[model samples]
Target: MRVDEYNSFANQLQRYASALSRLESLHIRLADGCRLRAYQKRLAQVTVDPRSAIDSQLVIAVTYDLREIDEVNEIVENLPATLDSETLTLLQKVASGSEHPDDELDAPGREAQYELYLGTMLRRGGIPARHGKPDLVATWHNKEFFIEAKRPASAKGFDNRLRSAVHQARALVRPGIIAVCVDQLVRPADGLMVVKDFNALAPSVDNLVRKFVVEQAHTLRKRLSTNEPVAALLLTARVPARIAATGHSSLGTSIQLHPLLAGSIEAKFASSIIPLFAGSPS
Candidate 1:
């Protein structure tokens, strides 16, 4: 995506978030509807780049501001040690503000940093994180808590790494992870539920984020070479069931993938038997 386009998307998101915050304090019937219509109107004012080059409905490009990264780094640094330490360290390294950082020179480098940051954040927040090859072992709560992180919102290109990663993650165990992908607008139709006319509804943010993660996960697994043992998940700002599958492959056996909220990863962990690592702070 072009710099100007990304800026427009970012600005619109900021406005939507702000509007929702204010709407929360008001008491009026159909208030959400009014807010959504206003948000849609404002969004229409922004220039949205065409998705011709990128087939996915999520945000086609991710625009990052060095200043914003710095601010996030400051917040992460100050988070309580009660959060995962290793995960925090990883976040600091990936999300920390840097001037013309090396990763900025290439798409792969940028994607790696984002994946690392997200992986770390999930792990730090008590969810397990791991990379697929080079002997990185996958572990889950009683073999129930499993997840995958994707760069749909940040990466360019139509590579199948997302699917590959999900397949690798599925190798861990039966009833394993619910793979996850991160992107904006899980699907365009999803926008209609959280947004009306043109505005975002105040109560939809949490649900939207959750669905984005779950659907991405689900999509990754559905394309797997073989049936996945676990379910799929898309976690983003919008929730849609588009990625959720109704049945399994030609194996005459059904493999079920689950679409869940990324935040709900914590809840899944709380109910799992997966062994927590010693260095884990959570």
Candidate 2:
């Protein structure tokens, strides 16, 4: 009511504002890496002008509004839309407790599956192929060899994955072939639950495939090509399947080929040798 009383009230208000600003600064710092919260905290804290002497009063006023029940309600109402769809879905999963957890990433196990499948595919055809780290090791036509697998064509970073696979394959042997496999998902059953979220998971499928097939092939090829017994090949999904070898020079390499869906894997294994020996060598 009096001049001194009004001054005292103003000072008290300013102190409260200062305290609120400090709290907001702390909140902003803590939220730095939190993508969604970071933006919200920033919008709340940004000063219209930082250099002005009266900016402190403005900051205090803003903080007062931001801390109110009404302002908190407003922020909560609009926070979800800015997040990515996948991240939002994950947030929902976290909220509802519906997401599944993986026991392990299982990189090597999948690699072994590719190795066994390639070996079975070639060996059944009497190519004398066996699974080897970095590539398949085979003794076809009295020559030692290596084979690498490449992933399908319609994917990104196939080249980079291929490079790493080649580097890894090189460690195992010299003169290897880098093979790629391109196709739709090839689980034994289309209806089976092979993937948790196929649409979300499809983009990453080829990366793993390349790791399983191409990386191994590149490693084996590098090792075999040095005349120290190495070879590599890529089994890309094609209308007609083919074989390629890159370990040897003039003697060259060969592929005992098979049709993409000639029959069950067992049947194709039996029939592939005819093509290996019968097809003209490159």
Candidate 3:
């Protein structure tokens, strides 16, 4: 990506973060019967950084989505206040735009967002998390788990996607790298399809979702070949993209974060932007 495009996307990512934050607040208002004016105030407090230039349309859409959120409880119950601030940084190299179709770049963009959302979730689980050489870096008890998330163009393509992601992750040759494929689970069979042992994390919605993903991590850890232990998983977290909310006043889109997983695999070697090492590399 050109320097200017990176700067622009960085800005868009920030707006997504800010909008997501405000949307969370909006949901809280509906849940508690509190006034939403607080969220509006927060929106006003955020002044767009000129350095991170994003499309004005996205800003407008997010603002509108915040104002128009119905099914407030569904969102309030499901949404988590965990968007990685690291998403706002433009650190990696982008492919040459001239070499790829415009649509081809969208996957990496979504993957970046996925990394931020997943990274934040890890942090919430008491893991020190951030973006790293693999995609996401999670620290727990002095060990690092390098996680790579793959989002195929659609949910049906998960098999191919996981295969590819595993190949990439296996190539890393790092001690703790974990590769996970992210898919969408809207049907019971979808969950079963993603997690070979999906039923273990059941009896509740959250447990079922989380356990299924975690199981994949355990599976991949057992399956892959490495001098050190690694993990591979299948994470199903997407759904058909539709407007979460709509309003004549403003237009916006919703970014939802959901289940994740990891496991092991075999493959070629690839270098990471950040080297994998034991413990926190301060």
How far residue 171's Cα lies from its native spot in candidate 1, in Å, is 3.6
Better of 1 and 3 by TM-score: 3
Candidate 2 per-residue C-alpha lDDT over 1-282 given as tens digits, one digit per residue, 9 for 90 to 100:
000001122333344345334434433222334322332343344433354343443333332222221212222232332343422332222111101111122223223323444544455455666443545566665765556654322234344545655666557534555554433222111221122332323223333344445544554344334433223233432111111231110111123232322343322333433343222111
Better of 1 and 2 by TM-score: 1
Which runs in model 3 stand beyond 4 Å of their true positions?
1-106, 175-230, 238-282
lDDT of 1 by residue, 211-231 (tens): 544645555445543454434
Candidate 3 deviates by what RMSD?
15.6
Cα lDDT listed for each candidate: 0.34, 0.34, 0.36
TM-scores of the models, in the order given: 0.37, 0.30, 0.38
Model 3, 125-208: lDDT tens digits are 456666656676666557555667765544345455555555656566564444432333232432221222223112223343
Cα lDDT, model 1, residue 149: 46
How close is each model in CA RMSD to the real structure?
A: 15.8, 26.6, 15.6
TM-score of 1: 0.37
Q: Could you tell me how far off, in angstroms, the CA of residue 184 lies in candidate 3 after the best superposition?
A: 4.0
Best by TM-score: 3
Candidate 2: list runs displaced more than 4 Å. Answer: 1-110, 150-154, 184-233, 238-282
